[model samples]
Target: MDEETRAEILEATNRALCEHGYAGLTVQRIADESSMTSAAIHYHFDTKEELLNAFLDDLIERFESKLPCGAADPRTRLDGVLDAVFSPKDPDSDGFPVAIMELKAQAPYHELFRERFLDFDGVMRGVVADIVRDGVAAGHFDEADPEEIARLITTMSNGAHARAVALDEHPAETRRVVEDALELHLGWTPGEEVDG
Candidate 1:
């Protein structure tokens, strides 16, 4: 109901998702993780699907909030966006990214999750597109279709996510690959100083 309570529930849900994954998740598991009764969870969410949907929404919001905005320089903004997207950390320990991968795998079978996935994909692409457009405008990047570049970046991020989840690879590997791709496509180098 309140923000604190909602946060608590979300935190518990994340822990459960990390420990058990979506396939193994249950209301009782979430309740146990949160130290609340199943009845309490039910009072907040009528169904497990509802709870998961809320979790997905919260997850997307948290990611979106981390995107850099209102910056005058394209390179700086692009760097921030790329870092957020390609953050190479072990998903097994974090659980949030792994949970996202689990939800994505379920999208084809579940219409609700599929729709949410589309929306999430679109939003991420739009953020990348905006950065690409800005970079081109500033003459930092060569002329190209912003949408296409955004799509490519999204694809790369997805692949990185898969590698991170499936191979249990280091996050730095994803970061290095993404950074190299950015250098080739956007002429932006990671860790390079850019004048605003």
Candidate 2:
């Protein structure tokens, strides 16, 4: 129940989810991956759904931590988010996103998963919307509905994630497509030199 133990469990769950997909995941597999007994996992999480929900919470927290805060420039903040979303470190490792996609596939049938995903999606869109709003206010971006722009960006990113995971496409290719979408829809591109 300590933080270290919980983190270990989550890490193991992530590996299991990535290797087996949600449909194939099993408690014994997670236990084996974590090098913990099945009884230990059960002591921490009463059910598989509970373990998955905990993993989702941890993922959301990590994502939020990556977003810019304080007085960071709007462009810098937006770029940070874009890079995190489209061109994440270790582009070849699709474990995190693949696990997320697997959970997404379960949303239709599981209310708990659906609620957690909705929360995660909302936070992501909210972060993008905030950046767009700041950019527009700073005259670095075209005046548009921030919410709409956020939705477009989220949709495009989701598509890219799916394609990258499914086709084993390079993350750079998805990054280019996302950048183009941002430029076309928001009139803003990360790291672009602008005349004062």
**Index of the highest-lDDT prediction:** 2
- Residue 41's lDDT within candidate 2 is 96
Reference-based TM-score of each model: 0.90, 0.89
Off by over 4 Å in 1: 90-93
Summarize candidate 1's per-residue lDDT along 18-53 as a digit string, tens digits: 889998999899999977898999999998778888
lDDT of 1: 0.82
lDDT scores in order: 0.82, 0.83
TM-score of 2: 0.89
Q: Write the per-residue lDDT of candidate 2 for residues 1-196, one digit (tens) a residue.
A: 7999999999999888888988889999999898799899999899999999999889889888877783687888888887778765464444867778788888898888888888888998999899889888989888889999788878877888788779867566767777887788778777686454
Which ten-residue region of model 2 has the weakest summed lDDT? 87-96
